[model samples]
Target: MPPPARRPVGTVTRGTTNPNRLRRVDRWIGYALGGLLRSAAGSPVVVDLGYGASPVTVLELADRLRGVREDVRVVGVEIDPERVERGRPLADPPWVDFARGGFEVPLPAGLGADARPLVVRAFNVLRQYDEVEVWPAWQRVVDRLAPGGSLVEGTCDELGRLAAWVDVRRGEDGLATPRTLTISLRLAGLETPSVVAERLPKALIHRNVPGERVHTVLGALDRAWERAAPLASFGARQRFVATARSLREDGWPVVDGPARWRLGELSLDWAAVAPS
Candidate 1:
């Protein structure tokens, strides 16, 4: 049988990433999966797939993930050979390297045939693709995971203040399943939870309509935020916490509590907000 068709490779993105532009998402990753990162025996590999023109985000991700696992190795993969060539000089530590590759995630052979990556963070990589193409793209990436691995695919603002992503896991059946949806906003500037509608992953971006589960979830979040306005007297953080708490009370299957809410993050089961 023939392999799946390779995705139509696209042009280089603007690749405009600042040092801290992805901090919010990185922090969430560290918090959400630190244990898995720390437990990998021999330097676990992590991929920053589609890291654009600048490799700064990849470097930053390495620095952050290292806090939890000192031996973590990060490979910044770019589809553009020129970008990879440009980033090579910046590879200081041997563990952090830049490679020219697409979603296939090519790595050095001796790293261990069993060395599948624990995490693949593909941020801002799918925003430009047709919404219908996302699932297959996600499947391609998830299929490359090591056992008990995760693929985090999402989009965030240039500065990372507003973002949303879906966590895909390689399930027992070898199929990737969306496990959770996470939204992080800058509470102070948040007018409504739906403001983040623009940052949803490609799979659900087009599903934000009247009867879709994502739309309903956003609507519920907006109403809960409005109902919690009384708590705004304390601060935007307080209001957000109250709002998340309310959603939990209303049976939205909120995943985290006040601690995570304080960071302007809300996570729910994928089933709760996935397109229906």
Candidate 2:
């Protein structure tokens, strides 16, 4: 029999980006995985996979994670050699670096195996691939994570106002499993919760059909959002908080509460929206 098809190693992305366009996701990463980053025996390594035309996001990620892990090492990986070379100048401060690599996440010698990365953030990367390719792509990346490490893959609008991602972790048994699915939106402009369906990670983007799990989750979110409309008289923030709270009360297993919801963020068990 033929061996499994080799996963694609690297491909150039559209290279679109803007500073702070990823703040919501970065904030969530800092909150959810900060402890693991801080607990690394030495400086922790983090990869900003497929960082686009500019290195601004990588710099920002380093700044954010540094608040929790002072010795965090952030490497911005780009498949485009020119982009990688262009970002090299900003790799000073010792704690940050830039390299030409793709989903395989090639790191320097010292940072491999026992010192493998603590986290990999691959936003807006897989959205360009066919829906069927997302699972193999996810598996390839997750397979390289260090034990207890995490892989965050998702997509956000160009301006970063709305986003959704899946968190996958390397289990003790050495298998990768989806842990949670999260959505962050700019509530003020949100018409319906379904607007975020456009930004679901590649894995679930095409799974938004009428009877799919994702569709049901969005339906629930829209209902909760509508039920919270009265609170909009106070502010969008209040309305979002109420909606998130309503989701939790309705058995969605919402992850954070008002503090996170006020930031236009909501996370639920992956089971809630996994393709079914």
Candidate 3:
């Protein structure tokens, strides 16, 4: 006999999705965290939570990660059963699948009980929830992660031009911790790196006000970006690289280097910009 299905944790989101809207984070998943997938025991499972009205982004995620690990499997998880049905026809099995779920992160039954996700990218999922709900939601997702797995949660603009996310991983104490805050921009038309403040994850969004650590960080990024304007004549990418360097030089604890900065992205220890 079939077992009764357990209810999925979390709630229905706006489900607003667009093609390529998640490219920046997907690049990060493929490039920066690709090693995790490669070292995983078996074919790694990645969860695209709250993949909204469409499954397009989850499909895109699968295609991108396949370049890193050919056996990578992606599950588009949505609390909306209708959206789940909408995505099933698009599923290619083993490579891509759609399931009705929320932060609980359900996988296909065939994957077996040991198949926890190596990465859970929950972009824009928590935006609709109160800031107070962020940590709890993160905990729920982290609890479902495979060892050494990570949960990337945050928000991005509709066009995918500006974005910010927190990479949450389990700590030594077996609790979730937001280890780093990453901001990715479309350098071609970028004005200032601080523009990401508007797209920060739910946890830090309201903390952008004065006196908060995140606010200070954004202010510093803006100043550094302004100081890099002369380099803009070379290219936005170059200018952004300079901006990233300046942040590190000024003791902002920037992570990565010019190689990543060239991608219009910057990352900092979560401690550096965590709410006061």
Candidate 4:
């Protein structure tokens, strides 16, 4: 019946971001979580925690969700006050706005205590935190989610070409329920899908070792990419598509179909990629 305990704002991130750098994840959220937004009981609040220097990604998220559910709202939370100030000029009232906060995911005071967000899209935010610090941060965010809400956190390269993220939901017990690990790449010049290793979320960054589940996933994905070489003439897109299909055929528990694969994205159950 009382308010949740508040946590001090986290440290400022590197604050490096570029236009379109997070387009991959943004598009994924729109297509993947569209149904969740539509069925939301009340107003849906989506948070873009640690949206670096530009508010472009948060704005893009707002735009994407608005296209599906007009009532969707987006709040861009940054630890740097200066970043918040710089992004305020672009705020668009009740739809899209920015505030200074951190992993604590502070909502505007006006929303009242129960205004838990429906989605918290945190990219490149936890990269700086120690791997041991990830779960607690995840708990802090997921604990604030509305029922059926999500906490999507990950890392990506500068140009937005390669990305890897973990999509987590909260359980009735108010703990994380990790669902999937998604790796998206630009197939044009992609040498191998495993190149996404450099962009793994903090949770799996160090876990890409011989004995880790993430390592096993990446290794298998790379091999699958190689075996799909005969499909090259069809196009890199098809090659990646077949690889995703092959992964499922080989019993990797890949969670998506060719529709997402054609976009150079592949998703597997978190248990398949989480540190073992």
Candidate 5:
């Protein structure tokens, strides 16, 4: 007789999902990890953990990544068996697949010796857990990463207009450390950059209060946005560029330059907004 199946780690989410809802993060990954994918040997796997209710995002990720690495494989993982089945019809063999798993990030059986994923995008997954549960969850996912791989985890609003995520990598000591915090916004009608406080990753969401580094950063962002208002006549994108420049000028350690800033996105060293 076959052995009993082991249960997947982590809880099922609310299953909320939508098409194009993950475009912001997908675009960021294609830009941020492009070189990593290009330099990897053979095919590199990417896991869309907790892809909740649909595989649209998985399909989208594969489509975007193929532009960077033609052989990139994408696996959509969920703890819910029904969601897995729901996505199977769209699976395209080795290039794109659906699996039933959680933070353990189980890969397909017999997927060669280098079966670990190079990038694990776990968006909107941990918001349902207690804040204390986050680090353990991150560690579980990070443990499954290939050398030099990354675990991108965060939360976003329903419409995907506002989003924030942490790029976590394994340190030399084998511990997972968040290396950067990034905020992406739809600047067309954006009122204040601090509005992202509502969509911050679990690690920093609650930390967006006085005495916390995250709070301090968001406050500075709001001030910068207001100061850049005069540039709005040039367009929202230009105004956002100015906001990003202002942040950098104020010694905020902004990561990217005008090219990325025009996309209404900004990334800062994790130390800048890590919880106090």
Candidate 6:
């Protein structure tokens, strides 16, 4: 089947994006899925779903993924045709392309409807949407994922200082669910880990109520960060690593080791911090 004729995917976004604004998530994508992308059978397709305002993220993604696999193909999709037009001039074909589309995860022209992508990065796109709309959006995008593919959804500050995202992948039942949630902090002049709460993806953002699981995890994290205060003398990196280790020691089900923790990132199975 072909995509809807004269039909576009989803709504137009806020169209606000900055250079390097999505670096942390991009870096995480590299660390988390680069191997899978590298070993894909052929040119692996990646969608920068709702890459707002600029093509920088798309271009940067291609450049970064090319570091893992030369044949990495990236398509920047935006419902705003103007935004797509803005990016088209900047993108290099074959490896990087731009299309006016949305959650349907439309592949560029010349690809079949079955051309599911190996990865879809939709950052800062859902924050403006009603919380109830998130899962439906995820379902739409997830339905387009190639085998072993992923849909990374999240929000970040304008400068990319703090980032939080849910890594959605196929669960044991072969349905998509939030698998891992990762929080990335800049670590420079950082005081507490809870600051990332402000950047949590909308799906989990409001769910940070006092009795909710996310709130519970955050409260514990803040306390552990304070307890690790003595390590501040060694530098923020050490303090963060100690705090992350503390999280694991306290049975938080941390999925990443000290290496990523030292980089001021902590990833855990989303079930551990999911909303009630």
> Highest lDDT among the candidates is held by which one?
5
Candidates 4 and 5: which is better by TM-score? 5
Which sequence of candidate numbers ranks them by lDDT, best first? 5, 3, 4, 6, 2, 1
Candidate 3, overall lDDT?
A: 0.91
Give lDDT per model, in order: 0.85, 0.87, 0.91, 0.89, 0.92, 0.88
RMSD of each: 3.1, 3.8, 1.1, 2.6, 1.0, 1.8
lDDT of 6 by residue, 182-215 (tens): 9999997998789999999998999888888888
**Which portions of model 2 show Cα errors greater than 4 Å?**
1-8, 109-114
Against the hidden reference, what TM-scores do the models get? Answer: 0.93, 0.93, 0.97, 0.95, 0.98, 0.96
Best-first order by TM-score? 5, 3, 6, 4, 1, 2
- Minimum summed lDDT over a 10-residue window in model 1 is located at 5-14
Q: After superposing candidate 4 on the true structure, give the runs of residues whose Cα lies further than 4 Å from its correct spot.
A: 1-7
Instruction: Compose the digit string of candidate 4's lDDT tens values, residues 92-151.
Output: 766788877887788876566778899999999899999999998999898888888899
Model 5: weakest 10-residue lDDT segment is 106-115
- lDDT by residue for model 5 over 55-110, one digit each (tens)? 88899889998999999999999999999999999988788888899999988764
Predicted candidate 2, C-alpha RMSD:
3.8
Instruction: Tell me the deviation in Å of residue 78 in model 2.
Output: 1.1
Instruction: Compose the digit string of candidate 1's lDDT tens values, residues 136-238.
Output: 7788788888777899999998888889999999878878799999999999867898899988988888899999999999999999999998888899999
Clash pairs (backbone) in predicted model 3: 15-52
Q: Cα lDDT for residue 16, model 2?
A: 94
